[model samples]
Target: MQSLDLRRSGAGHAILVRGGRMARLVLSAALLAPLGACGIPYGTGSRVTLSEAPPSAQSTPSEGIMQALTCMRDSHTLNRIRFGIAVHSDGTGKSSYGYEGATGSFLPQGTAAIWASEAVIRAGGLSMNYYELNTERALRQFGGSSLDTALATQQQTRVPNFIISTAFTALDFIGGPSMDIRAGGIGPYYNVRGASLEVSAEMYRPGDRMTMAISSLNRQVFYRDAGIGGGRLFGKGKGELVTGTIGFTDQQRLQEATRDVIALAVADVLASMPVVPDDCRQMVENLKAAHKARVNEDRPQEKPAHGSRARRDDLPAQSPAPRIPAEQGPASGTIANPDKARRNQR
Candidate 1:
């Protein structure tokens, strides 16, 4: 069982007084492909399919899993997801935006936003069921009912210009144990401990739609105090667990379980713009072509005689991708066919 140091500040005792309780939370991805639409929708009872080939092409199950996992690990691609709120003032002033997961405490600007997005996608896809449940659990545990209420209100409040972007990545997983004790009756409870607590996060986006859903469980055991007198105590042993989900509005849609979805969205949007750097587009195109060529080369083909061998000139020489700035958020146009964007990448 995990140990707590209550000697200082009686912190453990205070937590008990604050009314701690065992709870759980759960949360709910990306891509740009142009042969078809590129949005991934998640639900409480949904089954997701991954593909190594564009949606139209068939892939072995293992291939799809590998491709999905690799895409989620790319960090440079991860930075583009963003979340924030646009606030308008009465009469005279201009409108301003405040970011979610943004704070000067414990982390730098955008740190939480970035990490949270990655966490969601990596954990899985964010879904509505997970987001609402997780948020409710957190608020109840931390005495943040007011914030929870405010969030609920915001979901129903309609604003013309609101967008949220999210992605799934590796950092979204965490584990730990939490204990809630009832102490009003029978002397103060002491020496209670838990072991091996773990947590995972998922996120939902604009329109209160699910973005990514992630769930993680860990081993935990709770033990209470045993003794008499002022120091005397009776112990009851029970297990504890927590599950939760988070929702993001505006630019805050990214979650560890949805990074691939976000990236595909951004890539798709950028593909339509005339102003996007040609070099970047060329690079992505080149990558696609090279991948195609590699796939073709690996296919079964009849061996040719030395005298009839085809010249290298028959194959198109692939160009290398040019390095360019990363594109953020959803791109300019709706991706037409997702199959093209879903092309296999090694």
Candidate 2:
């Protein structure tokens, strides 16, 4: 093999570098380096950080969404009914965070309010945006020129069939900043951090704002911060070595958790209402039946255990084709089992 050529313009000289201790150390480190997608070992710093895949905005339906959607689908009158949602207070009352106050806590008041409005709209229910005053002003201005009282009758504010109001009930800190070390005191050093968020939603008639159903839901979000590192010390004397550590962090984004709980609470309220149209009754039943069938299909197929035989009763129910007696062949459709026939007669 050709020795490496070293060129030094300042010294105006070139040296033939033979493979020695330094060269061997470089080679070993290169071999131990982490590989990229193309299997090429790449240079890295002392620390590397990787991110977990966040939740998808649109994917498989969540439990809350499924239940709410199912009921909305069955009702079919959701579009005809309007919902007024207002969640304007901090009910949790826990007064602190690293960044802000209670009302401005991790789970803010606006989160519950907006999530409720979105849930109602997404589930095929008509909802009014009562929060923005500018939009209301614009609407009023647009309808103002309908003359005066004459136009008032033609355009008027819509009444909601149901009103949804929510308040944060509780926020509790769950576990810890616990630590663990392994692999000769150099494995993962991790801690568990979680917070439980609870909120309640009240649905009511808009006429008197009379409360109908209140659904309170709680969700606990758990996350962890962990780090691990390992390195090899090879060579009798001193050689080039690289020690690297990596961090795997799962952050607690409360918005998603809050959205989930809000969706479930809204579903509960909608499910309590018996406002489903009579025409939608059959369709709802069919939808439910199809959902059940899908669930069954997704379940894993079961088989008899090893060294075990299935009994006659263990098999699925199936009616065997009955054979006719030669005397009564073709003409008689009666079952051949006399006992079964007698039982049927009785």
Which candidate has the top score in lDDT? 2
Tens digit of per-residue lDDT, candidate 1, span 42-160: 66676556666745754221333334323433423333334332111112122224555543221122222343333324323221222124557677568677876786686456332
Candidate 1 global TM-score:
0.21
RMSD of each: 30.1, 21.5
Instruction: Please report how far candidate 1 places residue 284 from its true position, in Å.
Output: 2.0
**Model 2: worst 10 consecutive residues (lDDT sum):** 304-313
Question: Which window of 10 residues has the lowest lDDT sum in candidate 1?
Answer: 85-94
Off by over 4 Å in 2: 1-64, 94-104, 138-157, 182-185, 229-244, 276-346
User: Residues 78-105, candidate 2, lDDT per residue (tens digit)?
Assistant: 8788887774457777765556443446
- Estimate the lDDT of model 2: 0.62
Model 1 root-mean-square deviation: 30.1
- What would the TM-scores of all predictions be? 0.21, 0.52
| C-alpha lDDT values of all predictions | 0.33, 0.62
